[model samples]
Target: MATNLDLQEQEQIDAVKAFWGQYGNLITWTVTLVLVAFAGWNGWNWWQRDQAAKASVMFDEMDQAVQAADADKAGRVFKDLKDRFGRTVYAQQAGLLAAKVQTDKGQADAAIASLTWVADEASDEDYRSLAHLRLAGLLLDKQDYDGALKQLDAVKSSEFAGLADDRRGDVLAAQGKPAEAVAAWKKGWDALSDKLDYRRIVEAKLTAAGAQPAASGAAQ
Candidate 1:
């Protein structure tokens, strides 16, 4: 009985060894790939965190330059931010700040350049809309009516619908299209909530443009 048990144990050991010999390399390779992939994922996340931290510091420097009203310094720092971390939110915010300072310094071309970059390259839709709005204003100031309209056309977010309509009215009014301007202002007024004080301003615009607010349209 002891010899028979020993033989059975030896047979079990041989079966395990045979199975391992057939598939051992494949199992080893599969485990190696999984481990490498996990390590790579961890490394990528670590790299992004480090990149964001460094970008935040540079953004602060750009903000300080903007606060000082130093357009050149702000532009320089903004260039660094764009070159190194243009995909980051901090870089997009820095672009807006740098553009404002440039505008304040009478650098319309520089401001337009910065705004264009933000409009074209920002990943965030809200930032892109803001860039478009500001760019349209700048173009309108330069008497580029068509350019202003084109910028406004790119702003399609519902959150910015009211402002975009209002800006469209302004541009149309500047182009001497009173009828279109009034229509645009009516849309803007209707888009705003009744509780907002800004709704009153939109209503005033509509009144000035020979249009009645929806609430008063029936009375007229």
Candidate 2:
């Protein structure tokens, strides 16, 4: 009986070895691939965190420049942010901040460049809309009516659609098209939410354009 048990154990060991010999290479390669993919995923997450940490420092410098009203310093820091971490959220925020300082300093061209970059490259839809709206305003100031209209047409966020239409009305009015302006303002007023204070401003503009809104919460 003991001799039979020993032979059975030996046969079981041989079966396991035979099975491994047939599939061992495939199992090894599969495990290797899974480990490499996991390592790569971890590396990618670490790299993004490192980038955000570095970019945040640069963004702070740009913000300080904006608060100081120093266009030159803001421009320098923005250039660095673009060169190093343009895809980061901090870099996009810095672009908006720097553009504000540049616009306030009468550097319209610089502001345009910054806003255009943000409009084109920002991953956030709202940032792109804000950039497009601000760019349209700058073009309107320059009396580039066609360019202003083009920027307004690119606004992507539904949240800003009302503001874009309002700006469009401004552009149309500036082009001596009061009828079109009034139509645009009416569209804007209807798009805005009654709870928003900005909706009252749109309502006012609509009324001033000789197109009084049939419903307005401005009195409320």
Best candidate according to TM-score: 2
TM-score computed on alpha carbons, candidate 2 = 0.86
Cα miss at 162, model 2 (Å)?
A: 1.0
lDDT of 1 by residue, 1-220 (tens): 9999999999999999999999999999999999999999999999889889999999889978987999999999989999999888998999999999999999999999999999999999999999999999999999999999999999966778888898899999999999999888888877777777887887888877667676853211
Candidate 1 has what TM-score? 0.82
Cα lDDT computed for each candidate against the true fold: 0.90, 0.91
In model 2, the Cα lDDT at residue 30 comes to: 99
Using all chains and alpha carbons, the TM-scores for the candidates as numbered come to 0.82, 0.86
Residue pairs of candidate 2 with colliding backbone atoms: none
Off by over 4 Å in 1: 1-30, 215-220
